[model samples]
Target: MGQRLGVDVIYTGPSTADASEQVRILEDMISRGVSAIAVAPNDAAAVTPVLIKARNAGIAVLDWDTPADESVVDYSVQQVDSTVYARHMYDLLVQNMGESGDYAVVTGGLSAENLNIWIDEGLEYAKVKYPGLTLVTQRIPSDEKQQLAYQKTLDLLKAYPNLKGILGYSTPAPIGVAQAVQEKGLQSRIAVVGVALPTDSGPYLEDGSLDVATLWDPGKLGALTVYVASELLNGRAIADGQDVPGVGRITVRGKVIVMGPPSDFTKENYKDYTF
Candidate 1:
């Protein structure tokens, strides 16, 4: 998309969950005098000041996937409304678990704004809509790693043998949880649901280890980020309900731009998508 827009784009990400590395990368981008930057922050607070510096340097800052501090960025692009999406995921888990047992959440990391918000809203939703379900643990960090999540899930299973379901807020958590469940021959006992690429979760879904995986097109997200950055760079106004290339029509609320609905991958449909 940047190539089509005639804009030079450079992509960089921290090797681990290090906020300081993200800050350093932003500083490097500022020093290089890039015209625009689109980022999914690892830690919103830690990256805010550097984002401000980038904006002050006359560069357009676009926040994608995860939002940074709103005051420092021109716009935020998200997959869907966080509360709504969380409730939907929780509802699916409750349905699979028969709506009356203990469940737990595995999160990407505690500092991840979007994942934290999703888990919080899902917990709130469960309290109101599915009162019979009990949350077994507070949010547990997975470091966004499948292996770590797998280990943590095994520990949870050993600690709570009656665990009915597991909700994963990160992409890898559900896959890891499913693996743990499958290894223990408990697929029929514990349900797993989360945000995952179909390619990564297909085998688990097919074997009845995973219940559901939900996500938007990440390729579309990357394209939309570049498209929106180009629009801002060319002095184009982004209004509510404006059609963004590859993302469909998006709604602008405050400085946030929401991409359309999320798609769910089930056992029957997981084979259709590669990501």
Candidate 2:
């Protein structure tokens, strides 16, 4: 999208998903006088001060994937509607759990704004929509690591013998949950569902450990983010329900542009997606 727009795009990020690294990178970008900046923040709060600095410098700053302070960024882009995505995960869990049962949640990080939005939305929706479903404990934080998620799942298994479902809020969280379920041979007993990459989730999907892995196409999401940034840079307003190349229609509400809903990658179709 950047190439098509004839805009110079230089992609750089933290070597690890660390908030301090992201702040340093943003400082470098601001110093370089970049025309526009879009970030999928690792920790929204940690980067807000830097983003405010960017805004003051007359550099267009936007949030993609994860949101920062609303006052800082020009506009925000979301790959999917948070409410819809969260409810969908809950619906998947209830459907696969054979009615409704005790379920737990695992998240990437407590500081991730996007993850919390989904988890909070799902919790609210569950109380009204599926009253029979019970959350066994408070949501566990995995630090966005598969190994940590794996160990957390193991501990949950030992603590709650009747854990019927697990809703993983991060990419690595679901894969790790599925791994523990597979190892325990509890596929039929526990329903594992969450957001994850199809490439990384294929084996779990093939087995019965992971009932459903849901997410939007990151390639399309990246293109949409770049397109949105380019449009903002050109003094063009992103109209609601605007048709975008490669990404279809986008819904714009206030300063937020939502791409669409998520895609559920299951054992039957995980092979079709390469990323």
Tens-digit lDDT track of model 1 for 129-248: 899998888877888888888999999999998999999877888888888988998999899998899999988998888989899989888888888899999999888999876678
Computed on alpha carbons, the lDDT of every model, listed in order, comes to: 0.88, 0.92
The true-versus-predicted C-alpha distance at residue 105 of model 2, in Å, is 0.4
Q: Which run of 10 residues does model 2 get worst, by summed lDDT?
A: 94-103
What are the TM-scores, per candidate, against the unseen true structure? 0.98, 0.97
Model 1 worst lDDT window (10 residues): 243-252
Model 1 RMSD in Å is: 1.0
* lDDT of candidate 2 over 161-217, digit per residue (tens): 999999998899999999999999999999999899999999998888999999999
Off by over 4 Å in 2: none
Pairs with backbone N, CA or C atoms under 3 Å apart (clashes), candidate 2? none
TM-score for model 2? 0.97
